[model samples]
Target chain A: MTQSHLAPEVMARARDIVALYPHPRSALIPLCHLAQEQDGWLRPEAMAEIAELVGITPAEVLGTASFYDMLHTEEVGTYVVTLCTNIACMLRGAYELLHHAEESLGIRTGSTTADGVFTLEDAECLADCGRAPCLQVNHRFFGDVSPEGFDKIVDDLRAGRLADEVPHHGTLVRTERDGGLRVEAETITAERRATAAAMAERAATAAAASEAKANG
Target chain B: MTVTDAPKIVTSRLGYDDSHTLERYLATGGYEGLRKALSMTPEDVAKEVDAVSLLGRGGAGFPAGRKWSMLRKAPTSYLVVNGDESEPATFKDHLLIERDPHQLVEGVVIACYALQVTTAFIYIRGEFALGLERVTAAVNDAYGHGAIGRDIFGSGFSIDIVVHPGAGAYICGEETALLESLEGKRGFPRIKPPYFPAAIGLYGEPTVVNNVETLSNLPWVLSNGSAAFTALGEGRSTGTRLFALAGHVKNPGVYEVEMVKTTFRDLIYAPVLGGGIPGGRELKAFIPGGASAPWFGPDQVELPLGQDEVGAAGSMLGSGSVVVMDDSTCVVRAAWRITRFFWRESCGQCTPCREGSGWLEKILRRIEDGEGRESDLELLMDISDNLAPGVSWPPQQTTICVLGSSIPSSIASAIRMFRDEFLLHIKDGSCPQGPAPHG
Candidate 1:
């Protein structure tokens, strides 16, 4: 699985994502996601490729990638079980549920199982508060779960019964979009010039205001 | 009109199975608002929104129309739809996006028309995989149906919407931080004064950042007119609003109700709403707003869900999330969990928020685990007050964003309301209430 280059298809998709933004540097986070999708973890070579794609250094890519919890710099197991222990979930036996997940998965909250098939995390709120004690299997949600319900979910996932609904790690947005407007070459050029002029004017105005305050 | 009598506006199309599709959306009188908005001038459309007095639903209760008015007019102003609903127990936007995405898409196009902008971006949280998929499919379907892209609906107004996905970071929900993330950088919130989206924003250009729920109401506003919406709810809190009810309630879900007409008691106890606490247990306390708000005891249940009313009563109806706690619940554990969330999501841009959140969480956890001194409570107050002086509801912080100040809310509220319970944990050296949680 180790490689110095991103797969040809992923490179093509990366180029498409880059087109959606006005600046190539704006594509760094999405390219990081793309690299994670290609490999389970963000490999050094993949990060180098992304840095080259977005016109930044590899260290800069790593610095930004490390800031996010979803973009893993380290390797993750097959099923990343992220359980919520926030206020809403905690009010609903989330601690007990978390304890159950630890026991059944044979790993601690931030550790991986022996088979490397599952990595459990005590996540913050996933924003689905109605379904308390909610957990995610590689970012897909399961809610209103009890300790027994958690065990059953693990069993189903282990036996590959829920493979159709759940995909591998780093696989977000199962559906593809119909492509963005991407403005148009003429509009992009025009908008870029307009934005540059506005920024220059704004800087000039700020400098004048500061100078006036100093004089007073 | 009262809460029970007010008409459903934003959530009018929910509960239908095929509500997300363009076919079902067109069949159900969707995008008619866009058609009607196209017939009028952009100024007139903004005038309709101004007449409605709709407040922003993303924590801060600023008026949406006034926010649009403040946007610096330029040839290339951008409109960003903030669907990054990352706060705990705040899921109204999640529901609006998951079930009725076409409505949201229609709302975005309508907003673009009012702002007279040609490009927009819908930044949804990354954890919402299905919601992201549905909204993406809806945007594509919208393009195919000729509701978006060049010369929309043959009115010669062109617009482009990019469905941007966030890699998991809660701080990106902040509008300025969202812009930073959109530009592919760490999501540290920018300082205000010159950084308010109306002045300097995304890519150093003027931008209008509207919450998902606020924009979702635009279709209804245009469809029924501003007078129709303003007539439903009274005073500053005009039009119906969505509230996400969670925690100990039996029917914990999102409900669209009138703004000032509804009281906390009705929302938490109504048969069709929260459906009361489970197991016939008595209510102990509740968080009237989102997790960041101070907790309210049972006596404050009669206060109406109005921004002015709640603010006068020493809290805010932030993010429209109400969490209830039954008599069996442990207040210390609940407060500790909330503090823990703030600690995890502090973004580390400021020393007060990052370091303060961690210290607060550690101390709350210790007290919850019955390893507390009576003086630990005072120490908690001292640590919290250092971050936000006075430890009051309208927070004053030592850091850039309000998150640093928000660290004090739960602990301060717990100490103010239930000082004796913390003493019991300290005196008895164990939790008297035990692990009594709700689902």
Candidate 2:
């Protein structure tokens, strides 16, 4: 590699992620997600940097990146707009939203605007069946969007009126777990184990008998 | 007549105050099942699940207890919870993870305790940002309460759950592909017969891969008796299922229905379910399952919404995603859209899926774009035959995974059901009804 592209802190976090799994190679996808979040896309240099961190070749990294759809191998715009045009969305005016987006942005489905601000693409199902015609800006969900709604969001985004709507790549929602954890010391007596073992023997025999009857 | 609406088991706490929090989950007696399972032996826990006849809710409807029984007894077994709800029109698992994240964690704790598994992974879909965040925080909250870490509930049972997000691959919903993605590889389906996840999966150890909804039912099965769980439905298809109703319905949302109790008519026309088709239009056809499932005519609306009945009616109850299409919808265009999904999502590992899906899309696009020949109809069927090679309900194909069959299921069914529509396109050189179906 020419020079170390990843920041020192990013590299330190990458090492910690690698340490999470027993096999370091299992951290390849997470590390790639980290690099893309930093660079907005997976650049060749970023791939090389990740390969160094994960102890694998750059080609190995590319092979995995190319397989997944979200990992961009090339440069993307600042705001990546992905509209779900799959079956459920299509039934609820997704094509209209896509066509409206194409006309308003002056770009095709898979192309970016000339200003390098918006990249538009038709995505598959976003798993928001309740809200059809959904779209995502940098993977954040905007459900039940109409053409007018689409234009309004774009206008707000361009004008910086709604900055928090579009987060950086790979950043999802922001929520933390609450503190009232349930733990009791008196419940763990030796008597419970004996009762549990006897129940297990009866359950196993019943399961075996049922298995035989089903096979028969 | 509509089937009586049963109480929501999975979504019971959906709209409760602080539903996604560990506090609310605890107040509702969430980890009581895990605590009970920890008190019992692992085999008994598996038996309790088996007794309930809880089928995998992530499509395929395989018995969860049978899957647990097939564990290879390896010392290093792993539990993989599939939250990759990417089946088009399906979002029940997404709701489960977002609304009741700790419910899934509690299920994982019990499952790992039963299988003696230490390491478990929740493979959430990459597109699901809210789900990922909710599940991540839930895992942390679980750890804080000693619900997931060593000596859970002070029962000396240890399990750790890692929330791993997928990077935009629809095929990763397949259990084998999910395992491959967990190993940091391309999400490709492993060949069967030798590579079942139970025998060899996730770092070459015995693995149990259960769907999010399937695992979420564990706490219920362990808390209530197996007979109580089974009494909710009929026959082998017992327990409640989360049905994601979308498309031309007035109320397009997820509903929990007893497996054998609910019917297609109830899901589509019942006021409590789909609220009947939108605009009061006559239902022409609908996908009984996800897009991969074949389209069924309105005559089959009375069919029960279960695996056996739906499969007998020539469509699998896949992911329980019902996408209704009114008479205003064009059948040929719908088939093309579904076919294009399979074509794009094909992993390119198998020849039939890679090449066959693309060719089917091109032909359908040509037919839809008003540049069609009568022979293109025969050509589409021929291409479908080459991919699946049978007209059976579950076509006998030669691809690595069901994704190969998915390419032809919608196409073959559309041609069989709407030959006149295809002929009209060829006759008029376009969609006879309109110009390319705007919206």
Best of the candidates, DockQ: 1
Per residue, candidate 2 scores C-alpha lDDT tens digits across A101-191 of 9999999888888888999988889988689989999888788898889999889888987677667665543443332222454565555
How would you encode candidate 1's per-residue C-alpha lDDT over B264-295 as one tens digit per residue? 99899998898899998999989877888998
- How well does candidate 2 reproduce the true complex, by DockQ? 0.34
User: DockQ of each candidate's interface versus the true one?
Assistant: 0.44, 0.34
Residue-level lDDT for A115 in candidate 2: 80
**What would you estimate as the lDDT of candidate 2?**
0.85
The reply for model 2, stretches above 4 Å from the true place, is A1-3, A172-216, B3-5, B433-439
Pairs of residues clashing in candidate 1: A92-B438
By lDDT, who's the top model here? Answer: 1
Interface RMSD of 2: 3.6
Given candidate 1, what's the lDDT at residue B194? 74
Question: For candidate 1, lDDT tens digit of each residue in A71-166?
Answer: 899999888899988878888878889988888887888888989889999888888889998999988999999999999999999999999888
